[model samples]
Target: MNLESPKITLEKSATEAFNFLSDVQNFKKLMPENISKFEVLGEDKFLFALKGMPEIILKKKEVTPYSKIVLGAAGGKLDFSLIGNISEIETNQSTVQLTFEGDFNPMMSMMIKGPIGKFIETLVTNMKTAI
Candidate 1:
């Protein structure tokens, strides 16, 4: 699997950052407005269907105190837990790193190619407001 790890540094409180980043429901708001839809599967899980995108279901595989939230995403046909993953958070320095992991198929790569940067920028922009 090709892993794409993206990092961001923010000026915010630990509790604020953790709460904002941990809630999957806030992702659509935190994300760029270009994103069309986000569905929270549970407290730490979500299924996102981007505009002109394939559906992806994910779960928060791990979480730690103000430090991290790791998510695993996959197609329904696959093992579900082993397909794709995203990890992010910060306990110090007000910095955060979000990493995307999984087997990179052509479609996923294409989607990533077009908008990952904007997504990150808007994510930081919007989530910062949550602080």
Candidate 2:
């Protein structure tokens, strides 16, 4: 399954936003309220549980200074990647977008697409407000 989040114009510089997102712990503020647990294991890794979903651990897979951050989960029932893209709009403003890609069986993809898409959308929307 592949899903792209809406682009958001943020009231912060690209570097500022990048700094906020570089730390995985800050992600808790962007999660759905239904998230039941969150744990920060390292600067680049964290584990989280959603109300009706199994706990998942994600770690930074790659990053480029002030421009992009990619996160992925290692061996698991769900193989997925979440990417964040940032661009400077002005000295004090930036544009941000998020995309989520998941590798799942056809049946599971069809079953989870809607909910997962909405979840990513919510996360992107919250990023705009959270910044």
Candidate 3:
């Protein structure tokens, strides 16, 4: 598996941050135009159709106030599990740190290498604007 960590700083409170983060469906609006068919499931799960691929499921594994959240998604085509996590949330003078990490399968790693990276960047950018 390949792991990468990307962090984003947000100018928002913990609760406000959670509120914005918890709304899973907004991903369609936040992600790039290549993304489509976004569907939200319950509090922390979502399924979306990424261009050129079948639908993928993202399930929230955990969540903690002013702390962290972990989401995982994987399929047989992948050599390993793919897990994305947001952790080490801490408030600065007027900003909060939203740290993102991804663990990907060796075979499919390169396929998502750039898009996933961009996805995280957009995730933070949207979070900043949402909150």
| lDDT, candidate 2, 52-82, per-residue tens | 8888898999999999999999557788999
List the global CA lDDT of all models.
0.58, 0.90, 0.57
Report the C-alpha lDDT of model 1 over 10-126, residue by residue, as the tens digit: 566566677776777767676555567678878878877657766778777777766666667644743323211223333443765555444557776676644654544455556
Per-candidate TM equals 0.67, 0.95, 0.69
The alpha-carbon root-mean-square deviation between model 3 and the true structure, to one decimal in Å, is: 3.8
Better of 1 and 2 by lDDT: 2
- Residue pairs in clash, model 1: none
How well does model 2 score by local distance difference test?
0.90
Better of 2 and 3 by TM-score: 2
In model 2, the runs with Cα more than 4 Å from the true position are none
Query: Which of the predicted structures, 1 or 3, would earn the higher lDDT when compared with the native?
Result: 1
- Checking candidate 2 for backbone clashes, the offending pairs are none
RMSD in angstroms between candidate 1 and the native structure over all alpha carbons = 4.6
